[model samples]
Target: MSAIITVENVGKKYRLRHQKTETYATLRDTIVRGAKNVFSFNKVDKPTVEEFWALKNVNFEINQGDRIGIIGRNGAGKSTLLKILSRVVHPTEGRITMEGKIASLLEVGTGFHPELSGRENIYLNGVILGMTRKEIQKKFDEIVAFSEIDKFLDTPVKRYSSGMFVRLAFSVAVHMEPDILIVDEVLAVGDAQFQKKSAAKMESISKDEGRTILFVSHNMPAMEKLCPTSIYLEHGTVKKIGKTEEIVNEYLIATNAQ
Candidate 1:
């Protein structure tokens, strides 16, 4: 099978500011400083700026119909990598090549109009995913049923609980039938039953429909069950890419030793 996505030397850089801490000064010292500032050139303290690489020199290729799990500890750049893949953010020093329409659920309410009703947002998300009105309409009923938010269909999504928001968002993304599906830890907000249902759905899509999936989650069992291959990330770099069980074991051992 051909590779559906290729990431080459991908890196994302961010600038972080650190406030300078001032030592305690007496009232007299403060008055003298103020007087000096009034008579002399006004000097302002600037926060220290540091360049932080959220991801650096990351390279990977995902074949079509691959169910790949991205595993990492906090601040490992998993989310940043996903954002880059989904085109929510751009890499600073590398390139990515993708060959499919992508539907992503990176956050609970991503790609959703908070003020719009669930029914409206479904159509909006589908259209954004490159579906036409007729195509979205054809899948509308299935989306609503999967979401199990029928009673709230006409209600504004801003009023929805996080669980409801994820349900509706996942429902729309999956029903739109994109060739690549990207999901992050936002699914953890849903109930266990819902999470299980979502895993099953993702599995079905990848196996039966030949869709590619990139999943990121802290839930180890779920990740192992859903992904045949996995990538372990640490400190903004790829640590390993191989069988899910081996990667998961290595990650757990390293995490425990820390």
Candidate 2:
């Protein structure tokens, strides 16, 4: 099968500034500081900027219908890589190429408008995913039933509980039928039954429908169940990539050593 996603030497950098003075200053204080600086022989030093690279030199290729798990300790840059793939953020360096349409559920209520009711946001999110009105309407009832939010369908999502928000968002994302699905750990917000449903749905979509998937999770058992291959990230680099069991075992050993 042809590869659906390719990532090459991807890196993301963030700049942090350290300032000596308070961020907010009154007009009078600002004037006095300016005068003092001008009169003094020594000039005030500028704030220092530090560059932090969250991801560095990452490379991978994912084929169509592949179910891959991404695992790492916190601050491993897993989230950063996913954000780049989802097009939420651009990489500081390197390149990524993807085939077909992409739908990502990186967090709860990712594309939802809080002021809009669940019913309205469904259409809005569908459009954002490149679906036409006809496509959204045809799947509307099925999406609502899967989410189990029919009672609050007309209620603004701002009034929803976190669980309700996740359920509704996940329903819309999966049913939209993108060529590739990227899911982060947001499924942890749902109840056990809902999590099971989500896992099953993802498995079905990748297997039966031949859609590609990128899944990130702390749940080892769940990853073991849903993913045949795994990538272990450590300190913004791919430490290992292979069969799920081998990669997961290596991760466990490293964690114990830590």
Candidate 3:
């Protein structure tokens, strides 16, 4: 039970631009604006830039086979932290070390190509998750069976509904036998039955397979049941990390106070 993942003093910063002019302009418009700024006597106001910190001084260590839940109000950087851990985005400060392969289902069709058929995206996403073609093939049928998207397997994923995308993506991610699994709130798109199935699957994998999981969700009960440990984030910082029920209750009280 050594630590499988370590996040040290992580922080992410985003620059928010507030511009009076349109953010996107055609080539002709850009040229014209450039000429005005270069030669015209009129002065143009510059867009205002604001610095926003999505995560600040966040630090944690996840043990092998640990099931951890992340909870926070909107804008608390929970998703940002997950993205950093998934390598989809890097932190503006600090460093992270990971010991094993990771599969992340952060959003609908996260690593999928919209123009690719469902079957194609499955292989494509599987590869991105560090699975070899042979490994993916071995689990192909199981993934398809769990997703229940066989009929639409040949269809381009662009045609799929959000729920369909989530089902297929989740299926491939979890079935890939990744050492670490990261799931965000995209599971909300699935139906209730599917959510239950997903929760059960996550629970089983962590217990039976010794897989590590980092889950982010607003469903308090599900988080409590699936994750024995939880972290509560507030204003882009780690507010608390401890037993799931205790952290959940503290979050509820804090949220109610605001």
Candidate 4:
């Protein structure tokens, strides 16, 4: 099968400012500092700007119906890469080509309207994911059932707890049935049973419906079980991409060596 997603020389750059002061400053301190800086002739207190690359020269290809795991330690550019793929942010360098509709659940309340009712947000999120009203209506019942938040269906999403938010968001994203699903570690907020159910659902969609999935998680066992092929990222770069078991092993060895 041809590749459904291609990432070529992808990189994301961010600016970091280092201030010559206490890391945490109160409002009063900030105001006083600003006044002093404005009146003083010296620029020694000015923050130094530096460029930080969250991702660098990352290249990968994902085939249709593939379940791929992205594993790494904190600050490995995992979230940045996902945001780039989901079009939430643009890469500073290189380009990405995607062949199908994509739905992403990168955070608890991502793509959700906190002021809208759960029922309303379902339609909203579905529409955002490229589904028609009829399509969303067709799967609305299933989404509610999967989320198990039927009682709160008409309640504003702002009233939801983190777990509830995740359930509703995950439910909507999956039920919309986008061609490509990009999931970050937000699922870790759910209960164990819910996580298991979600894993099974993702596996089913990829295996039975031929959808492509990119999963990022720190849960090793879950990652191993759900993804046959995996990419190991370290320090904003791809360290290895191969069978999940081998990659996980290598990552673990390196992590333990540190």
**For all the candidates, what are their Cα RMSDs to the real structure?**
5.6, 3.1, 2.9, 3.6
Residue 42 of model 2, lDDT score: 78
lDDT of 3 by residue, 105-132 (tens): 8875667999999999999998987789
Tell me the tens digit of each residue's lDDT in model 4 across 1-258: 889999999999998778756666789877887888999999546678789999999999999999999999999999999999989899999999999889887865556989999999998888877789999999999999999999999999999987888888888878878899999986576899998898899899999999999999999998999999999999999999999999999999999999
Candidate 4: lDDT over CA atoms? 0.90
Please give, for residues 1-258, the per-residue lDDT of candidate 2 as tens digits. 778999999999987667665666579867876787788777565446789999999999999999999999999999999999999999999999999999888876657999999999999988887688999999999999999999999999999998898899888888988899999986675899999998999999999999999999998999999999999999999998999988888888989998
Q: How close is candidate 3 to the true structure, as a TM-score?
A: 0.86
Which is the leading candidate under TM-score?
Answer: 2
What is candidate 2's local distance difference test score? 0.90
The superposed Cα distance between candidate 1 and the true structure at residue 198, in angstroms, equals 1.2
Every model's TM-score: 0.85, 0.88, 0.86, 0.86
Ranking of all predicted structures according to TM-score, beginning with the best and ending with the worst: 2, 3, 4, 1
| Prediction 1 TM-score vs. true | 0.85
* lDDT: the better of candidates 1 and 2: 2
Model 3, runs deviating above 4 Å: 21-44, 111-116, 155-164
